[model samples]
Target: MTNPLKTQVLIKIDTITYKGHSVIRINIPPQKEISFVGEKAFIREDSSTVEAKGPKLLAVSQLFQK
Candidate 1:
């Protein structure tokens, strides 16, 4: 029998890290450029509003680089 895969998700905002089964990682670039990860990515005018908008899902090396 084969074991199931264990998924790990992490969300880092400033110096705080939120751990869960699903996460959204947002990277804010200098100037007006904004980047994000996961589904339902919403880039608001404020950089503090980015978050996971849907149900939990597995993510491996999922990143949004600007």
Candidate 2:
């Protein structure tokens, strides 16, 4: 049997308290379906959101075909 689909994202955000080594990690599993905003796809890098362009845009477009 196949696992149920989960399109919701799970982000892990850590709160810093004591001063020491801090780490930020995000786990984005492989996408089963692509989502768009205003007819464009955007990727999140750290704390920035940038539009996908060139080959990236092409790849995203292909997802619709699948």
Candidate 3:
């Protein structure tokens, strides 16, 4: 069996890790209004999670690129 999301979980002797390597596609109609809460709209850039707003939101939507 395999995960449709192409996600992987590994359990070490003392630690657990999860990894995902896949492209996720979402369809949002043009001019659609979308709202995201503070907790939900975060962009992971390098080692930090940044609040997604203005240009940052566009940056975050790129998906799996950050």
Candidate 4:
């Protein structure tokens, strides 16, 4: 399953039996900083994540340019 944080993080999960008891083990790798979405960029404003538009979009592009 993917991480709930929406980083598209990959996870490894397994089930094991120990002493007649079942246990679940989850392994989560590190996550990297998220650049804007591939198709469209987004910015957070006032506790909200909104699509970058107009000036905001340009600013985002400039800030994140490789």
Across 1-65, the per-residue lDDT of candidate 1 in tens digits comes to 01111111222233434574454454432332222442344434456644444432112113322
Off by over 4 Å in 3: 1-35, 38-40, 62-66
Question: Which stretch of 10 consecutive residues in model 4 shows the poorest summed lDDT?
Answer: 1-10
Instruction: List the candidates' TM-scores in order.
Output: 0.19, 0.40, 0.32, 0.39
Greater lDDT among 1 and 2 belongs to 2
lDDT of 1 at 57: 15
Q: Indicate whether candidate 2 or candidate 4 has the larger lDDT.
A: 4
Compared with the true structure, the alpha-carbon lDDT of candidate 4 equals 0.62
Stretches of candidate 4 exceeding 4 Å from the true structure: 1-8, 11-38
- C-alpha local distance difference test of each model: 0.32, 0.61, 0.45, 0.62
Give candidate 2 regions above 4 Å deviation: 1-8, 11-20, 37-39, 43-49, 53-56, 63-66
Give the Cα error of residue 11 in candidate 3, in Å. 15
Q: Note each model's CA RMSD in angstroms.
A: 13.2, 6.7, 12.3, 9.1
Q: Candidate 1 has which clashing residue pairs, if any?
A: none
- Where does model 1 exceed 4 Å of error? 1-17, 32-66
User: How are the candidates ranked when ordered by TM-score, highest leading?
Assistant: 2, 4, 3, 1
Model 1 — which ten-residue stretch has the worst lDDT?
1-10
